[model samples]
Target: MSKFNYVLNFSPDTWTPSMESKAEENCLGGIQNFPFAPSMKIDRLGAVCDFSYTSYSRGRDPKSSQPDNQDFHLVDSRPFPKTKVRYVQRKFQKETAQAYHQKQQQQEKAEMLLRQGKKNAKMRQAGTQQYQYSRHRFVSRMRTLTEWSIEPLSSWISVAEIPLSSLPKQFLDVSKSTIEDIGWFGTLKSYNKSMDRISPKLPMALKDFGNMEFLQPTTSDDEILRDALLQPEKNIDVAITDQILACLVAAAQSKYSWHILVTNVDGKLIFDKQDGSIIDLITVNETSAEPPLPDNVNKNNRPHLLGLEALKSNQNYTQNIQINGDEGIIKQFEPIPFSEEHQDANVESKCYRYRIFSLPPRAGASSSENAQKTVRVAIRTEIDAQIPNAESENSGFIFARALNEYDPKTVKTWNTQLESQKGALLATEIRNNACQLTKWATQALLSSCDILKLGYIVRRTPNDRESHQIISVQSYKTKELSAQMGLKEENAWGIVRALVDLLSEQPEGQYVILRTPVKHVLRVYRIPDEESSELPQDEQSHKE
Candidate 1:
């Protein structure tokens, strides 16, 4: 057997051995041929001693001095030598107590205010209560309109003109123009053919009713405005533009679920409509007492199809008249790139006129420093055709639109009713096509167009859907037409200003002002950057 020399130190004050070393030694002794050496090395290890004890008498023991029975009491005691954990616990308790007391005080104060017949005070207190519990998802309340005194700027200054070169070169005027002579406007034929080409799977019967093609702006208004503002020579800072303003103005009357995308880029608010948004589609009988049925159920009476037909008719009518009219009266702009199919044209009739209007600050904000910063807005308005005599100051331009009747049997004949019961017909139309007429009036007012010409066209026969004949053309002053439609320009402007101010309060980010379905309420939602692309897709799905 091999003997191993081991030095062991057993000093309680200074000596300690790790558990790993102890385990290794134990394993070595068990596996190998090592025997324990019992040597009296007092200096290397430690000295051991034994104690001698003396016995004590039971009568004189320490326990005999105390009482046989003892009483105990529980007492709350503070921790000694305060640590970070104890300090934090005390701070939290103090804050909780303070908050409880403050809430109690506010409740008592609110009750007192309510009992004192101070209505305004109660309202303010209620607002405060709501504010404390409000979350980010809670929509801000719209401002109450106590007075409708909004007015447009004394004069509007022309900003810039977007050319109409891209528009098909054709005369587009309906004044003194008959539909029979024009032969259904060749544009509709091409538009319908393109629709058919895209939807090869659609049934042939569906093609005759015209596919429900909701015409939307090729480029979003937001993108157009952004690009327009980028021009070095055109430096304009506007809180809101016409597209958003128009939506806001007509919000109270809108029945559809539409949303406006608002992006605050570098402190500038850009209002945009999503791609294929239904908001751009001209609605037919949307606000009527007996509105048209859904497109899926009624093929011919579909609002979208009717609106598209009317839109195409108006476009064709305006282009033809402008093309055939005097060349000197036509307003021309720098030509833009045109499609090969529409390259052969006499002149372009469509032109965009940009103007700026200064909106007054909020009512109560007159005393604030921000009152000096009046809200200025820019609008891109369109002109369908110039007045026959452009030199006349009374009427320099006119806005024209056509209202088509698919079946005169359902309603009164336009030719007879328009002359005898014109007022009744107008009233009926107001009830049925409230949204369409409102939009037309809004557009005309935005452009300050002199005249609004409405053409009444009906199909040649009840069975014939393609061929239509114009019965009569009625023209009204823009302001008079707005009044007839019960549109309060002042109130519209007020709504626009209020919405602009409300949106301006939000931080720099993207927000959506969604008109809730089945409710007249508009809710605001913030969109995360990652999910921003999904908004347009969502809108498209809704459209489909």
Candidate 2:
């Protein structure tokens, strides 16, 4: 069999002995064949085994000896003395017993002190107490003292700017009021003023509703409508009501008597106005979807949103699409749900389905082989494996690999300092080089390719008899790394990690096109030439 590298992901992780046993059993049972090891991490600091997974079966142990990763040695290295394990265990037991005895003594002392204190407090209640007498106040004081260890890092961030709006509430005030209430807001007064524009009788008149489509209605019933239609966490206007309305209207304009099933973001049925019967209620099992985003697009690009938030929130608003016919207008679109957590999703990118249905099936592979869930699970597992654990980490951690010419650590530290000081100068500095934190963090992670390449294995279950689940990881390992530079196994990690990252992201390799009134051109560029292009000497180093 050919040696192949596999990236094993444990939902919880790290490989342990029991998992190793199970894997051996499975292998012996003819379930599968071959041996697997957690990937080793190599970095500039040198390669170190990152054995987060303890459940992984090391190998078949005909001999009784088993050890944690690094517990055993190669032939050249000195063997572990026969007495080493026993000595370590004895020392551990001895220390444990001492600790237990000390703890008991401490507890007795504490009890005695508590009793004395209680007596003193009672005496004070008899008009002789030395300090505050209220038991509630004493507990409060203790809590306050305990809190001193906590560094004050406010999670409340001060956004540089917010568009003239709040986070979308579950209920948005009416986005549109009646025509009589707000009236049409365009350059044209009535149809008479702009009669020459177009034949108004075409199916739907193009009157400028201005911002009315996004405005909150002033009436109480509109508020009631919102309350009845959406979830407390979602606004129906964006996900369902408004989008469905646009879809239905577009469908209507096409002369199709079509009614669509509008679903909540969760894919639960919100409206199923099927062709004329009592708008039937139908609920099918949930579905999921995934769609990719443009590399240059900011996450927060809402057509209606105007500023900073619109720049940061990478929320999807529209997608270029050709519906039933090709070369159609840039119709309103909702991206197929990319996050599988919300089960009721359908991919907006119908390209795959289109391609498949267009092709003839081959004999060996079944269409079900392309089941989207399996594909998605594989993809998610791969991508998520690259991400760092964010739990218990303040402000969470961002994967540096996904960033574009930026470091996350610098930006975060600057922001954190700025928030702590509330100083104008520091704030201004932070604003100026605002990307430093993001850049730094990205650089750090990228710099430490060893940790990533080796994979983080952990055993989450410490006591499972049959599983080596010390931290939830089964095993993690890196694929065979190509030898780069003159770095040894230890030094190779960072060298290749950075090298791979650099090669993947070429700064000059951006596309830009210019349009002159009636025409346009497509252009591609690699990094600007220093000799041909006017690259300042000081600025040249930043170019990669």
Candidate 3:
């Protein structure tokens, strides 16, 4: 027992005459050993069986000096002490350690037998090997599943019970996540971690806690284990499996951590966990971002047909959407929105302004004045490549041209189509939608790792005069700042000037990880917050 249990002595009259003497009779008798110690007796099963109690037949009046301090009275001294408990626990743990050792021995023996290679023992060896392999794999999987630092963490039970008898049969494949499924996740995890916290305020007496040292009888722990929980064999379930697989894919594809948007068939972002700094506004499968969809695999989930082999659901939805008005919806690109938190966590501005270039326009009223309209629309950030700009004579400009020049009616119409069936349609239907051509064209300059090989950093050094001029101005900040300073942009001379200025003017003992478009996410973890006016913590005055 983790704590002691005994009847309290209330008022004097509360104790019946017969109960007075009998209080001590059965009170400590149930306790097998009086002062349970390591050398104390234990059953053959290696369990410490002992209990102690101060029984009182009735309550005592608080004001009364003392009626009689005879049979069954509470003592003030701390009854359970270290020497006794440490000994008992040592014995119990010894047995547990022995069992663990034996299992290890058996596993190694099986391994040796496997290596010998005998005809008669072949089948046995094979079985042994499989068992060993499976156990090893299971342990590895659990480590990954829980993200636990210790390999034996799963085995480190708090000894809640001996025989988990109350477990249901249907609960064999049951796992930690399933137990969490019994309620919300994280709740049960914290609850079980609090074992002995329940108390007198608990409206009832509880587990062993007093200094009345004795090994906890296995039964109490058995009760705790049986009543407290079900046997959890694993944590990964179908949904968790999907998430883990997705993480592996994302990790492979991304240079920096990105946020994940989990949605159901409706495509609304439901679960959001951002890794690095990236505030990604979430939208469900290009539809209305609102009430989340219910999770039902069979009926509604329009599984994303990711990476060919995945989600090969040969259902009727694909064929159905092709002939229906939903053809364009099936082919749209679903960009995951990231909602990352950080002052400057590599956030790409969503509203990138694009300038229309039309023959620099004729200088007359006949000319369409707004023809070179600067349309500033919010677009999703490019996950793979920096979309070239026309000014660059490379990618961003060309990409912008295609996007701005697209048929407004088609774009607006298809956008409407996405919103209409936001939740009801299948994922396949959305993919094969009529906009497949538009989607492909947009992503063409992106990571067309499969087609157009047009995305990577290209470095070119400047010529003599250009390099000399830029280097001379070398020092400060943004290109805009350099231009304002009237420095030549011929060869990054302004950039050099900006850097030199920043080095001299910037405060000491500060670090910065600044990045702009065309640069990867820069994670700058400041070692100190110099801007804060708070005095040093160590300088606080201490009361004498």
Candidate 4:
């Protein structure tokens, strides 16, 4: 049999009586026994057994093999001196570098403060107020008006001061009385009288008034005005100049695009070009004033129909004037007394005023260029969404008329425009184009009675060329299904499979793939069609 059965294990006890004698005998045996001693018989098996017993029994189980000494002993001393010296040198260098950087920071801060002080001094000297040239110019023009007319009640109506350059030499030499009291239609009448004044014809149209207070100005307006002013060689008609100025003023009031509409004085629509999708553009005259309907005629009434004016005679009713023979109870109607004081109270003045004029783009105009140019003057600026405060008035403006360094020469058309076309696919163009198969798949996926939902798997693979695939029409084995579902069948794979099948059946287009794992929904993006996958992101995305 085995010698292992003869071995005996004992509990760990250093105080066993036989151990002290055995240890002394073993020490003596180790010292006395030599390989040359013929008198000493060596039993290898017995010696091995004795060694095993000594190692296993009465072993030091209560004690650990850790060093007992706490004091440090210098075993290797050469590297310590060099390491200590290097550490001291590094500490000194770090302190020097920190001090130098601190000095530099202090110097920079002092210079910045000095520059700020100089800027403050200059601002104080310049009176800290921006020059408002618009109000000044308006006031100067008003002061230059030498001609005035008296109304029925002696109220003064200022005759518009027409620049001599705007009219022909014949009109300048003609009597000023011909231009007087042309009524609210004075501007149009003047333009008609000086028909040959235009060197380059301008399209006349009704102004579409936009928000005036919050308009962001563009660089094109500035350039146009500057070119008109500085370059006298340019054939800019007075009408064109006036129209441009009106458009600029309207743009300065709002960032929205206003359509150019040509209409008559009686508010008849002639020509209109759509500006934007927002339908709030209000048609006004060249002076930017909306036309008001006459009190007798409703604006909605047909222009051909004329209604007779109703009689204004008042009927008085008094209970005191009633006859004594009257049987029915007569209701007394008394007029409330009007107070002169209340009627004489002055109303508050308006903060802003608008003027209206007929645009140059009349229906009978000879040239279509003026109308086209006016219609093409589309300008819009992005409204700043920053929190409003006393400061931060610098709003950003984007002028589509000018090209930037980074902007493409040809603006890339949006995919949405193509997608909006009938039967246009945004992603992959159909290859097989089988309508029946797709229809059947869509019907099968939508059907609630289908029991083989776990057959399909929508999975993403490592291959970039074919990263995503939906393996439909293949059922999962019982073991695999149990493993995937953590041994509980909740019909999760079935639902995913149905969704995948439905999406795959649709004509190549944008599709949303959603997954509900725990409580919240997760999005798993499948690869789109090969062609659309390479299209650049939206301009807004690039900006962000």
Candidate 5:
């Protein structure tokens, strides 16, 4: 018998066996008997082990070196157009079948729900019409109810109980005729004419109350309404009262279909109507007990509001403090440090301070005597991480020598001076007021400069949040001017900041072009121009 044994070593080391003579008797004659020593052919397994997948068949073209049927198919098979997986056949159509079933079920459910909704809608409409009719009848009986001397039901009467058969034993009483005089304002012929008359009177009233330019030229009745809703405490002024009445009167007389909304001084008696048929009444009764004080009343309820006494007491008259770029002097403002009872490990705490410069004389002071007199009020500022620009280090706090000297950059000192119940209330007020003033000033500035085009710039902060910036320039010249200013067209935020700084620092009466992502061209106007009287430079700086 003949046998072959082989050993393979993949290692790098090579060792040679010592020279030894084979025993003549033991030596096999198998190799001598074979003519070519078995031809030394490599089998399929051996070829695979060597990583050679090529075929050795000679029947195919010699030039075609492909190994397997796959390679031949790839090289010579007819091309087929690509198709989506859904179009192709699969063993299990689980997803496709499930999607079809879900869609059918959704359509059926939607149809049923829509039918039910239509039925409910019809019922609701019928009920609404019935209620409105009954309400009209009940209101018409107001004259009869008053003549019978029956006490009026509270305004909280449920609509369900408003019967058409007979008037309720009790009905809301009407007060003295305020609406009778409302029509006496003598209706104007056109809305534009009424607006023209009321618009001029609004500013005059504001000025008469020593509030210079408090109301913008385009101040809308809606804005006044919104302010009354949001800042009730701040609305307790003669100017605001007159402004509201004037706006309401003008709107009522206008040709437009404006409905009247009546509410008491306390807003408890509130009602609205379209026809102006009912006269809602507000009155005080001697027999009724005084309204109870609000359960939540506190001394600092409206710390931002300045009553006549407070305003008179803190009446400050000073000159504008030139902005000193000296950090050494500015840093001398050591206001009381901020403190928190429960500080969080994850929350970052940042402190800021704002100085309100050139507060036009208290709302009712004569501007003639105090034309040059200005007052600076400083308040502590805090930025929560939640706001987009809270992390920004640029606090934009302006400083002047004539400002109230009680610690300009300190939160605690300002809180003490303002007699704030909570340290944070005044800060909120300052931010709100600043945003309001900025909105008005921007509109006025754009109008005064006769520029209709403006650009809005925005950028993402480190936290991946966006902040907005306004950039004004001459129309359609952003690209050309951007090149002149050496600004990158893509770096929108940087351009806006640089341009704002440049324009603010420039001398008055000079025009500059600023580029933004917006397409509108804006004419740049500084606050100190002829329109300076409309918005003070100090207020403008605070807004900026």
Candidate 6:
């Protein structure tokens, strides 16, 4: 009945190919009648569709049925509209101009405030008596050392034994021992002409030491921790395996520029040192009033060379002692002979003990509930050798080190100084090798060593670097040595805790903590992902 069986409601916004095909089908009859006409006509909704009076017409003829005055009369009787032009105001331009003015005003206000603040600060400084001195005079003022001094007591401070019943529950509770001896002590042989020839009374000459090779650790602490303890599943808050605790403890007294690499992997803090970092190179007379000059022509007279020789001497002395094959006296994990190719090379002294100590949460950390939870920190410490107790059944562990003397004239005859003025010699060493001794003391305390042994070594011929002899050996209780060095365990632990807390605040990333070249301040820098991937894995893993 209608034009077509289906109703067509075409919309330009919702038009489809199906609608177009259907319209063509309905207009087939019209297209045949008028070949030149369009296939179909589409009109917008609510648009006029009637076409009886819509045709355009030229001037009509007088004979036509239409009125002759049709052209003179209005078609719809509508009046001619008055033409008008309107200009629309653009809002964006006005808004842009207002914004620019506001910005300019704000900048002007900031500058005014800055100038006013500076003026006020100057006025306040002028009013204060402390700021009365001229800038040059204040900067050039002479500084004097404090005259008040406290003499370190030579006697040991005995700690009163506390009854087990009087101890707190927290103090009594001990975590499972995590002491692991990943390496072993090499076979102890007397440093005589050969392994077969051994003597305790005869002091071995340095020249006889001959061609002694120093083995460096093939596996760095960072790699060891990453492979063993810092697995993806493991969650460690703080890791101090790179002997960073010693550095942190002696940070205040540090004079040289040093840097520590810190990596935060999934919120775990790892402290590491770069390959061939200066921290590993043993330093001699670093804290002396007049340290060795870099231009010193004599290689043997240089601080680093002297330190290396002294280290070699200590290692040779300790390893050469006859222990009667008593390797099992102190527990060793995997014992292996010293080899240059060995992954776990027997470094200085051919023995190292790694013990993990748990640190309690720092006091007054935060008021948050998460902060209340105890944060666990694992610190790995190293001990050099064990002193077999002849009188008692218990063996005493000791940290053995050698103090070498190259030129006796520069300081004094060590043999003569050690005999009559032992205290004075120690004082001089305290002034000269402050950092080295501090680190040694800290390491000894951390490893729970019973004694600290200092072997006095001097060149047999003052001019000769190849020949040297041990003059005497000195032993001090670990605590006594620490006290003598003015090191407090609480202070050291506090410094470590502060560093841990600071690192924890940073986002998960690799950071470097470096000492400023001109100042003693340590700064932290975050390493970008692009730069971190460029670092060599081999270099990082096999650092000395």
Top candidate when judged by lDDT against the true structure: 6
Report the C-alpha lDDT of model 1 over 199-282, residue by residue, as the tens digit.
112212211213222223432433445554565454434434444566666676766556677776664566776654556555
lDDT of 5 at 339: 19
Residue-wise C-alpha lDDT for candidate 4, range 1-544, written one tens digit per residue: 3122222323265322333344444444544445554442334323434554656554455432334444546587556455546888899999999999999999999999999999878766765343345457666544322111110111212112222222111111111111111011000000011111211122111111121111112223323323432433432222111222233122212212222222121211122222221111122111112212222133321111111000000000011111222232122212111112234442111111111122223222234343312111111111101111213222111000000011012243212222243133211111111211122122222221121121111113222211212121222233332333232211222222222222323343432222111112223232244522342222211110
- State how far residue 205 of model 2 sits from its true place (Å): 45
At residue 541, give the lDDT of candidate 5. 14
**Per-candidate clash tally:** 11, 73, 59, 16, 7, 1
Once model 2 is optimally superposed onto the true structure by TM-score, how far is the C-alpha of residue 260 displaced, in angstroms? 23
Put down candidate 5 lDDT per residue, 205-297, tens digits, no spaces: 110113211111111222332333345443221111221222221221111111122222222111222221111111111011221111214
Candidate 3 weakest ten by summed lDDT:
184-193
Q: What is the TM-score of each candidate against the true structure?
A: 0.54, 0.15, 0.16, 0.14, 0.17, 0.56
lDDT of 6 at 41: 38
What TM-score number comes out for model 3?
0.16
Q: RMSD, each candidate, Å?
A: 28.2, 37.6, 35.9, 37.4, 28.4, 33.2
lDDT of 6 by residue, 19-48 (tens): 544565654545455447563434432233
Best by TM-score: 6
Reference-based lDDT, each prediction: 0.53, 0.24, 0.24, 0.24, 0.25, 0.56
lDDT of 3 by residue, 238-307 (tens): 1211122122222211222232222221111112222212211111122212211222232221111110
Off by more than 4 A, model 5 = 1-91, 112-120, 127-495, 498-544
lDDT of 5 at 432: 27
lDDT of 6 at 38: 64
